[model samples]
Target: MSFDGLVTRAVTYELKNKVIGGKIQKISQPSKNDIVLSIYSLGKSYKLMISANNNEGRVSFSNEKFENPQNPPNFCMVLRKYLNQSKIIDIEQYKLDRVIIFHISSIDEMGFDVSNKLIVEIMGKYSNIILTDDNFKIIDSIKRVNNKMSSVREILPGKNYNFIKSDKFNILENFDKDIYYIDKKTPDNANPKELLYSTYLGFSPTIANELCYRAGIDTRVNWGLVSEDEKKALNKNIIKLRSKLLENDYTPTLYKENNKFKEFYSFRLRHLQYEYKKYDFISEAIEEFYKVNKSNDRLRQIKNDLERKINSHIKSTKKKITILDKNLSKENSMELYRKSGDLLAANINKISKGMNSIRVNNFYDENKEIKIIIDPLKNPWENVDNYYKRYKKLKNSISYAKKDYPNQIEYLNYLLQLLDFVERSDSINDLDDIKSELISNKIIKDSSRNKKSNKEKSKPKHYITINNSHIYVGKNSRQNDYITLKLAGKHDYFFHVRNAPGSHVILKTDNFNENDLISASYLAASNSSLSNSLKVDVDYTEKKNVNKAKGSKLGMVYYENFNTITVDLSDKPKDLYKRIQ
Candidate 1:
């Protein structure tokens, strides 16, 4: 899984053969941390991707599609100024370290010839893509590190580019036998694997383990506690390793678990064994690994963002509904105001002004005596009018709340439905559809709406039931509307989860039997928020009996003459012919 020294060497070898003479045709910074260069060579095109992401930095030949921003980044523009249309004359690796350099030739503004070196350092967190002239004076870099950022090495313009100095000797080029001797005074606590790899450039831990294993030396053994015979075996294997690497006899291999990639290296790693696949070139293996990993990471980020936005709105909606419920509770006392007013009106003629309360007979309650408290500063009739006015105000407020509560609840349900959609989405396209729905509903702001919509919209997933009947499940709100309102036949059966946000599922056959209906119900339940419920209620009715609510949101509908089917999700079939293929 590590993009180690050998992997870098292999990628550089392939890139040299394919792109040495290629012209830099396009330069794009698809993301802030990555760049893709389109190269034209030997009557063909190639994309060389350079990534500076801390966790997943690499230099590889990639054909993966990366969407570019509408405005090119400043570093991208800087690269275009110097490298655009330039021919790559040479590609070199820096002493087998994780750094690659490109010697480029181009014509300047005044028709003067210019030579440049574009350096890519693949160190983990300090990775960078730097451009400099032939004298090594820096031009600009994809990532700018000022003095405040790193006092050890400042990668900025107008500064001399410095190689990260390492005291380690080259294992192949400068092989010294005296350094390998295990002396009585040598340190006895260091791991043999660590000692070998740390003492030489381009020697990885895995390769060191292999060397130790091949020499009959325990990789866990202390480096200073080796015997003469074991040292001889180690020397023999190290020489063979040098010969293999020098001769470019690498076997590009990738280890996998359950068809998912786990580890990859330029050569066969003899120290470890697992289920693996071999490729003709290391670029292929490396590209596929990064593509899948990067895509998964990107999707997770977006899903979290959308989930955060939706959950915020859902929280606010619930709070608003709680406040409205409290207001509605005031309706309980509205009748008291009306009754107080009635009692005061009857006692108005018997009372004078400035009386705090009037004692009277309550004819409405079996003629029992009742007391009505009033404003002593006002006449009895004036107090009666004040009570009446207060009662009418309470009536109006309760009435307004009664009418608005259902609408607010409906909107809250709609937001909940969108949240469910966000969780079930598996692809960027599905998420994009949901994002567009949110923007259209004014729930989110996105400027991409002004972009062209010439791309055809994706459709719902269509499936074939066990009875050879057809079923469809919408993946988003737009598709839900398309399935229920535009695609379904009037006699077709409509299926949905009864009190939850779910996909709109439609059965496209009227002559279907019980099994067909159940299959449709299964689709509806599986694609819903209630998919994991022990028992799920799915309502099914003829499409003609379902009507979209007037002035309501998309996919919001009411149905009558429907039959409910109880589905036990634990009894789901292994396969219901879910796809047409």
Candidate 2:
């Protein structure tokens, strides 16, 4: 969205210097909404990327790699047919708007020379890449728009291309003449940010606020309230800006807040007042901005999708636990079945065939007489066999349920642990580990069933104490396993939060001091869900005391010979934690 008209002009200036006399050596459409052209000029080759993505559209010299499709799209084919091998004659902007037009010279079918125009519009959602003949007749476009899309303009083949006219004045043409128009036309109560972009062709909201800020005027005040001194300062600033633009002098900068990209432009932004990084050229700034933003978008989508699936499984697992608890409550019924079998066998000798019911059973309970039901059709022996069979069936069911109940509970806990890992993951590699674990557990199908795992495993967080003691902390289940089972020595100490989900911290030295133990315990507490608490109980033991829990998921371990440490985080050494980047 920051790719405004000024950005387009800066890019055009960049291309004019690099590729004006270059030949189109190669062309490829790496994505449906992007095209990359390889240009050879003055013994140098540059790959220029142009995109028409609705949210992220720009033109820049890119070094990023992309996977090209084997079968090109129709638009890509059309561009290759008409523009390939053509020499770039000139590059120009359309009156300071967000449009870059490239002039190309090539031979026609009959070998007659022809001149063509390649138009790139960087407007959001309406951005397009178009080709036309010398007479401005549309040849083809990357995105075709008909009347259904926009009644003002149709970008179909054979139509006379009508460049959209802007009522706003171009400030770069002649500042002396344009200054008059701006002074006379700006309304008294107009918002400075809105008025600048609406009055001038290339002035965006960012630059507008910057212009006000540089002039030492309060941006919240409307034009009518600005003092005469502030007005003169504003005029002076605009004149300087115009001169810089005319002289092709720019300081391309990328603004960041907390080390994350906030905005980028052709010139330094005064209003942002954040940590700003400088770039030699505007193209590099644009490329880096696009790459960072695109990667972030991809990461967010993947994270959301993986979390959705894991949450669904977690819900189902909880439901199963609920049902299992209900079934286990029926275990008391097994006793009733066993008691009835005993009573029937005891009264078998007193039973008769014609009797429907009998009271007897004083032997098993103080010999107190009790009533029993019998079938007249079946004999007493048959009734005894039926009671015993019922008792056996109930006992078998109870045995099976009890045996499986712990395993199911363990499985549910494992999923909850994985959800924690997913939430805390900071990189795509960490998520990949969690996904692979899910596949191995048969919770999800492996899409790349035949793919080989050649990537190196991820490492755990490493911290050292002030005394040069080494410690390792795990952020996920796989990393926990690696730290506890692989990296830890038998005599080394390990720390984890008591009866909670947390990281595994391993202290790799045998002869450790009290300070070393405190540092390791602090790490175990800080990396857990209860880090914000005033105090957290952490348990530590020798690595030999820790063993993988049976019939459970990865990272599930039981330990012995351990002692509890209440980690307050403030109790650790002042300079104890030094992380290895």
Candidate with top TM-score is 2
TM-score per candidate: 0.83, 0.87
Q: Per-residue CA lDDT of candidate 1, range 159-229, in tens?
A: 99999888776755756633355334358787878877887687778777878888888876786677778
User: Which 10-residue span in candidate 1 carries the lowest summed lDDT?
Assistant: 177-186
Error of 2 at 268 (Å): 2.3
TM-score of candidate 2 on Cα atoms, chains taken together: 0.87
Tell me the tens digit of each residue's lDDT in model 2 across 1-581. 48888877888899999999999988999988899999999899999999988887888999988779889999899989999999999999898898999999999799999899999998889989999998999999999999999988999999988889888878887665443456676678877667778888878888888988987878787877877787788778888888887888888999877546789999888789788889999999988887886666666676787788878888988887776677678777666666767888877888888788778755657987777777888789888787778778777766776887787777776776777677777777777788888888888778985578876666788987777878998867888888899989899999998887778899987568888988898888887766778799999999999999655688888899999999996665578669984
Measured on C-alpha atoms, candidate 2 has an lDDT of 0.83
- Report the Cα lDDT for residue 522, model 1: 82
In order, what is each prediction's RMSD in angstroms?
A: 4.4, 3.9
lDDT of each: 0.85, 0.83
